[model samples]
Target chain A: MKAVEVKHLYFRYSREWILEDVSLELEDKEFLAIIGPNGGGKTTFLRILLGFLKPTKGEVKIYNKPPNKASYLIGYVPQYTTFSTDIPIVVEDIVLQGRLRKGKFFYTKEDKKIAYEKMEILGILHLKDKKIKNLSGGERQKVLIARALSVEPKILIMDEPTSAIDIKGQNEILNLIESLELTRIVVSHDVKILFRKVDKIAYINKRAIIHEAPQLNIPKDRHFCEVELIDFLKGEECGI
Target chain B: MWDLINTSIYAGILLSIAIGIIGSLIVVNKATSITGSIAHGSFGGIGIGLYLGVSVIVSTLFFTILLAIVLGVVSLYFQDRKDSLIGVIWALGMSVGIIFLNLTSGYQADALSYLFGNILLVGDSDLKFMAITDLVLIFSIVFLYNRFLAMSYDIEFLRLRGINVSLLYFYFLILTSITIVMSVRAIGIILILALFTIPPLIAEKFTKKFYQTIILSSIIAFIFIASGILISYYYDLSPTPIIVLIASFGLFLSMLKRS
Candidate 1:
C-alpha cells in the first residue's frame, strides 16, 4: 500500500503560491528526505501533509484516507525549539502525552508500560523522573523523539530534527532516525548526513523533483560540503 | 469571634480549590491579565443586578461568562492586541458599573463589599453557594485533567491529535469566568488575581508535576488564608488584604530562595 500520495497539490498564502503542481508518492516503509532552501514551502508542505493545513487545490491521501483521519497513525516530531521549557513537566509525563485519546481522562497501567518501553528504546528511561528543563539539547531532542514513538505510529515525520544541536549530536540523532524501520519523512538541510541515509530525495523549490539516491553518484564516505551540495543542485537544475 | 473564624475557614477552603485549579491553568497559559479582566468586568453585572432587583451573583456570573467569551474570541483572532483589548474591557466594565450604580436611587450600602470583599459578612447562603462552586470546579478538573494538561502544555499538539482545541478553549474560559465570579464575594475582585497567581508561583518551585503543583498550591493557599484570617482577627482588620499580603510574602520568599 502507498503510504503517502500527493496529486497535483497547490497551496497559496495570501497571494503568492507556496507550493505549485506538486505530485509525489511513497510506498510503505520507504525513507524520503525533503531538502530545500529556506522559505521554499518545505515546512508548509509538511504541515499540509500532517493535516495542520489544507492544500489550495488537488488532493492528499495518507493510506487511502484524508490526512486528518489518518492522523492517529502518523507520528510527528516538531522542531525542538518550538517547546517552552518554563513549564514544570517531567520526561515521563511528556512521553505519556502521546497515549492521549479522546475522552480518556486517566492513564492506564498499559499506557504507563508503553511510555516506559518507548523511553527504554530511546535509552532515556534513566531520565524519566527528571524535569524537561534540566535536560540538555540533545537529551531533550531524544525525549521528544521518544514521545513521538510512544504512539507506535505507521509513519514518522520529523521537521529539522537536528537543527540546533551540535554536529556530534546531529550525527547521533540522524543515525538513530536511520535505524527506525517505519515510513520516515524528514525535512532537513544537512544534506551530507541526510543524503547518505535516505532511500530517495525530494528537492523542493516551489515544486518538487524526486531522485533516487543511487542515481546521484554521491560519495559514501566523503562529507558533503556546501559548495559540493550547491554544485550538485545546480547540475540537477540544468536537467543533468 | 468563633463564628467569624468558622465562616472564614469554610470560605478559605472553598476559595483555595478554585484558586489552585484555575490558578495553575491561568499561570501556565499566561492568561493572568485575561482573568483579571473577567474579575473586574463582572462589576458591571453586579450593577445591573442591583438596578434590576435580581440576584447579584447570578447576574455577575452571566456578565463574566459573556466577557470571557468575548475576550476568548478576540484573543484567538487578534493575538497581538489582546492585552490592550482586555485593558479596554476592564476599564469599560468598572466604568459601566459605576454609572449604573449612580443611576440607581438609593445608596449602595454593600457595594464596597464586592470591590474589596467582606468575608466576615458571609452568610449560610453564601457558604452553600461557595460549596457548590467548589464541587463543580473539582469535578471539572477530575473529568478533564488529561486534556487540560495537554492543552496547557501544547495546544497545537492536542489539535493534531484530533481534539477540539477551540471548543476546549471556550469551555476553559467559561470555567475560569465561573471561578473568578464565585470568588469575588470572598476575595474581592480587586485582590483576587494575587490569590490566583501567588500560591501557584510558590508551589511551582517545590513541585515538578502538574497535579502536584495543583495540590501543593491548594495546601499553601489554605495555610495563607487561615493565617491571614487569624492575623485579621487579632488586629481587627479586613481579611482580604491580609490574605493577599501573606500570599505575596510567600511569593517574595520563594523568589528570594531562588536567587
Candidate 2:
C-alpha cells in the first residue's frame, strides 16, 4: 500500500483557495520534499496531510486510512519557530509526550525505555534532564526530532526542520534526516535537501507539481542556491 | 490571633495548591490575559448574587464559568478578534457588576470584599468549598497532566496525537474559572492574578521541569501568604495587598538575580 495518497485535495482559509486540486502519492518508505514560497500553501498541504485542517474538498488517506486514524503511524517535527523556548519542560518530558495516546494517562517504565532509546538515537540522551530553555537552537531541533522519533512512526513528517539553525547545525540536521529510514515527508525551503537523495519533490504554489527523482536535473558535485533552484523549477522544460 | 492565623494558613495552603498547578499552566500556556479577564469578569457574578440574594459563590461560579466558556469559544474559534474581544468581556463584566451593585439597596460592603478580598472574613463553609475546589483542580490536573503540558506550547501536536484540543482547552478554561472563583475570597479578583502568576514566574527560574515549577510555586506562594498574614497581623493592615506586595518584591528580586 502507498504510504500516502492524496486524491484531488483542496483547502481554503477564507474565500480564495490556498490549495486547489492537489494530488500526489508516496510509496512505502519513500522520501518526499515539499518546497514552495511563503504562503504558497506548502504548510497548508502539510496541515491537511496531518489532519490538523480538513481539506475543503477531496480525500487524503495514509496507508488506506484517514489522517486521524493513521495518526499513531505518523511522527511530526513542527517548524522550530512554532515553539516557545521559555517553557519550563525538560527534554525527557517533551520526548515522552510523543508516547501519548488515547486513554493513557501516565508514562510507564516501558514508555521511558522507548523515550531513552529515541533520545539515544538522536544522540541527545545526555541532554535528557536539561531544560528546553537551556538548549541551543540545533540541540532543541534534535530534541524535537527525538520526540518525533519516539513515536515509532511509519512516516516521519517535518516542517522546516533546520530553518532556525546555523549552517553547521543545519548540516547536522540534514545528515540526521538522511539517516532516518521511514516514509519521510519534509516541508522545507532549504535547497541543500535537493541534493540529499530525496526520492521526489512536490513544488506547491496554489497548485502542486510532483517531480520524481529522475526528473530533477541537478548537477552533482557543484554548489546550487535557492534562486537557481526556483529558476530551474520554473523553467518550462522541467515541466511546471 | 491564633485562630485567625490558623484560618489564614489553611486558606493559604488551599490557595497555593491552585496557584502552583493552574498558575504554572497559565504562565506556560500564555493564558494569563485570559485568566485575568476571567477573574475580573467574575465580579459580575458576585454582584448579581448580592442583588438577587443568592449565594455569592454559586453566582460567581455560574457567571465566571459562563464567561469563561464564551471566552474559550472565542479564543478557540476567532483567532483575529481574540484580544479585542477579551478586553470587551473584561470591561463588560466589570461594568455589569458595578451596575448591579449600584442598583442594589443600601451599602455594598460585599463589593469591596469581592473586589479587593477580605481573607479575614473566610468562614468554615468557605474553607469547605475551597477544599472541594482544590480536590477538583488536583484530580483534573493529575488526569490531564500530559495533554495539558503538550497544550502549553503545541496544541497542533496534541491534536495530531488524537487529543481533542478544543475540548481539552474548554476543560482547562472551566477549571481555571472555578479556581479563580474559589480564590476570590482569599486574594480578591484584582490581586488574584498576582497570586496566580508571580509565584509560577519565580519558580520557573529555579526549576528545570514543569512539575518542579508547580511544586516550588506552591511553596513560594504559601511563604508569601504566610508572611503577608503575619505582617498584616502585626501592622493591622489588609493581608491581600501585603501578600501581593511581598510576591511582587520576590519577583523583582528574582529578576535582579537573573539579570
Candidate 3:
C-alpha cells in the first residue's frame, strides 16, 4: 500500500517556486533518500511532506489521511537539534516526549518500557540517566533517534539528521533507520555513502527525478556535472 | 531584635526564597524583557483594577493573561519581526494605562503604587499573594518542566511526537506573564524583570541545569531584594532601584568572573 501520496502540490517563498506541481507515491517500509543541491527546495518539500507548512495549492496525503491528524503514523526529526544545552534534563525524559500525543494512554508502563527498549536499540541505554547536555554530539543524536522511536511511528521523516555529525555517526544512524522496517524519507547532501542504505533516490533540483528502475549513473566525483544513483540490495531483498 | 522574627518574617523569608527559586527560572528561560514587558504591559489591567475598585493583584493577572495571549498571537503573526513588534505592544499598553489613570477621579494613590510598586507597603494581603504566586510558579514549573525542555531542545522532534509547538510556545508566554504580574507589587513594574532575570543569568554562570540555574538565580534575587530593603530601611535609600542595581551588579560580577 502507498504510505504517502502527493498530488499537484505547489509552494512558493519570496518569488521562488520552491515546489511546483510535485507529486510522489511512496511505498510502505521503503527507504527513500531525497538528494538535491543547496537551495533546491529539499527542505521545503520535506517540511510540506511533514505538514509543517500549508501548501500554496494542491493535496498531500499521508497514509490516505490528512497530515495534521496522521501524526501518529509518522515521526519527524529536523536538522537543527541543539537547544537549551543547560536545561538539566536526562535522556529518558527527552525520549518520553515522543509519546506525548497518545492522549491519556501515552504514559503507560508499556509505552515507557518500549521507549527504554529503544534506548537499548540505539545503544544509548547506558546514557539514559545522563543529562542531555553532558552527552557528546553523536550521543545526543542517538538520544534524538531513541526519542523519535518512542512514538512507534511507521513512517520516519528526517531532514539532514547527519548533516553536522561525523561520518561514522552518519553511517550508524542510516543503518539504524534502515533496520527499523519502517518507511523513511531521509534528506541529505552527500550522495556517495547513500548508495547502499537507501534503495530509492529522489534527485531534487527545483523538482524531483527518481533514479530507481534497473540501474543508475554513478559519478566518480561529486564535482562532476552528472550525478549517479544505483539500486541497492535489490538482488537480496531481505524479508524485513 | 530576634523576637521580631516569626510567621510574617518566616513568610517574608519564604516569600523571598520562593521568589529567588522561581525568579531564577524566569530569568534562565530568556523571558526577562518579555517578563518586564508583561509587568509594564499590565498597567492597563491595573487601571481597570483601580477604576472598578478591584484588587490590583487580580486585575494585574487579568491584564497579564490578556497581554500574554496578545503577545503570543503577535509573536506568531510577526514571527520574523522580533523586538520591534513587542515593543509597540509594550509601549501602547503602558500609555493607555497612564491615560486610564488620568481618567479616574481619585485613584491616583492606587495608580502610583501599582505603576511603580510598593514592596515596603506589603502587608498580610501582599504576603498572601506572594505565597500563592510562589506556589503557582513552582507547581507550573514542575508540571510543564519536561515540555519546556523538549520544546527548547528539539522542537521539531517534539512536533513529530504530536506536540503542538505553537501551543507550547504560547503556554510558556502565559507562564512568564503571570510571573511578571506576581512580582510587580514586590519589585515594582519597571524593575520586576530585574528580579525575574538578572539573578538567574548570574546563576546560569555557576549552574549547569535548568533547575539549578532557576534555584540559584532566585536565591541571588531574594538576597538582593532583602539586602536592598535592609539598606533602604537603615540608610534611607530607594529600595526598588537598589534591588535592581544589586542584581545588575551580580550580573556584572558574573560576567567579569567569566571573562
Candidate 4:
C-alpha cells in the first residue's frame, strides 16, 4: 500500500498561491526528503498532510485514507525552534504529549511506559528529567523525535528536524532517522540530507518536482550548494 | 480591623490560586499581551454595566468572553496583525469605559474601586463567589491539564493529534476571561496583569516543570499578596498597588539574581 498520495494539491494564503498543482506518491517504509527555498511552501505542504490546513484544490491521502482519518498512523515532529524556550517543561513532559489521545486526560501507566521506551530508544532516557530549554539544539531535536515516536506510528513526518543543529548533530540526527523503520517524510533545507539514504526527493517551490534519489549521484566527499542542488533537481527528469 | 484583615488575606489566597494556574499558562503561551488586552477590554463591560444599572459581574462576564472569542479568532487568523488589534482593543475598551462613566450622571466613585480594587472591602458573599470561581477553575485545569499543557507547548502538534485546537483555544480564552472577572474585586483591572504575570514569571526562575511553576507561583503569589495586605493595613494605603509593588520588587530581585 502507498504510504502517502498527494494529487494535484493546491494551497494559498490570502492573495498569492503558496502551492500549485503539486502531486507525489510514496510507498510503505520509503524515506522522502522535501527540499525547498524560503517561502517555497515546504512547511505549508506538510501542514496540509497533517490535516492542519485543507488544500485549496486537490486530494491528500495517507495509507489509502484521508489525512485526518489516518492521523493515528502518523507521528509528526515539528521544528524544535518554533516553540518558546521558556515553557518550563521537562523532556519527559514533551515526550508524554505524543501519547495524548482524544478523551484521555491524564497519562496512564501504559503511556508512561511507552514514553520511557521511546526515550530509551533515542538514548535520551537520562535527559528526560532535564528541562527542554537547557538542552542543546541537537538534544532538543532528539527529544522532539522521541515525542513523535512515542505514538508508535507507522509513518514519521519531520519538519526541518536538523535546521538548528550543528553539522555533527545533523549527521547524528540523519543517522537516527535512517535507522527508524517507519515510513518517513522529512522537510528540510539542509543539503546534508543529500548524503543520506533517502529514497526520493521532492523540490517544492510554489510547485513540486519529485525525483528518485539514486539517479541524482550526489558525490559523498564534496560540498553541495543549495542553488546548485536546485539546478540539479531541475536538470533531472523529475516532473513538476 | 480584624475582620478586614482576615477577609483580605482570604481574598489574597484565592487570588494566588487563580493567577498561579492561569498566569503560568499566560506566560508560557506568551499570551500576556492578549491577556492584558482582555483585562483592559473588560472595563468596557464594567462601564456598560454601570450605565445599565445591572450587575457589573454579569455584564463584564458577557462582554469579556465575547472579546476573548474575538481575540482568539484574530490570534489564529490574523497572526500578523494581532499585536495591533490587541492594542486597539485595549485602548478601545478603556475608552468605552471612560465614555460610559462620563455619560452616567452619578458620582462614579465606584469606578475607582473597579480600576483599583479594595481587598479590605471584600464582603462575605464576594468571598464565597471567589471560592466557587476558584473551584471551577481548578476543576477545569485538572480535567484538561495535559491538553492545556500541549496547547501551550505546541498547538500545531495537538491539532495534528486530532484534538480540536480551536475549541481548546477558545475554552482557554474563556477561562482567562472568567479569571480576569474573578480578580476584578480583589486586584482590579489596571493592576491585575501584574498579579497574573509576575508570580509565574518569578516562579519560572526557580522551577523547570509546568506543575512546579504553578505550585511555586501560588506560593510566591500568596506571599506577595499577604505581605501587601499586611503592609497596606499598617500603612493606611491601597492594597492592590502594594501587592503589585511587592511583586515587582520580587521580579527585580529574581532578574538580578539570574544576571
Against the true structure, candidate 4 reaches a TM-score of: 0.95
Candidate 2 lDDT by residue in tens digits, B201-226: 99999998888999999999999999
Cα lDDT, all candidates: 0.86, 0.89, 0.71, 0.90
Descending-DockQ candidate ranking: 4, 2, 1, 3
RMSD of each: 1.9, 1.5, 4.8, 1.9
Candidate 1 lDDT, B50-139, residue by residue in tens: 888899999999999999999999788789999899999998888888888998789897678999886776778888888888888899
Better of 2 and 3 by DockQ: 2
What are the per-residue Cα lDDT tens digits for candidate 1 across A60-123? Answer: 9999999989888888898989867777688998888888877677889999999999899888
* Per-model DockQ: 0.66, 0.80, 0.39, 0.81
- CAPRI tier of model 2: high
Model 4 spans with C-alpha error above 4 angstroms: A14-16, A221-230, A238-240
What lDDT score is found at residue B10 in candidate 2?
94
Q: How high a TM-score does candidate 3 get?
A: 0.85
lDDT per residue for candidate 3 within B1-259, as digits (tens), equals 3332233244346456565565654554555556666778888888877777788778878888988888778766676875776787788779878887887787387576665564565666666766776787677677766666666666666676676778877877876676667666666687676666677667767765667766776677667767776766566666677777877887887888741
> What docking grade applies to model 1?
medium
Q: What is the lDDT of residue A115 in candidate 1?
A: 92
User: What is the DockQ of the complex in model 3?
Assistant: 0.39
For candidate 3 chain B, the 10 contiguous residues with the lowest summed lDDT are B1-10
Candidate 4 lDDT tens digits, A1-240: 899999999998788899999999999999999998889999999989888789888999999999888888889998887778777889999999999998778999999999999999888999999988889999999999999999889999999999878988898889999998989999988777877999999988998989889877888877767687778886646553
- Best candidate according to TM-score: 2
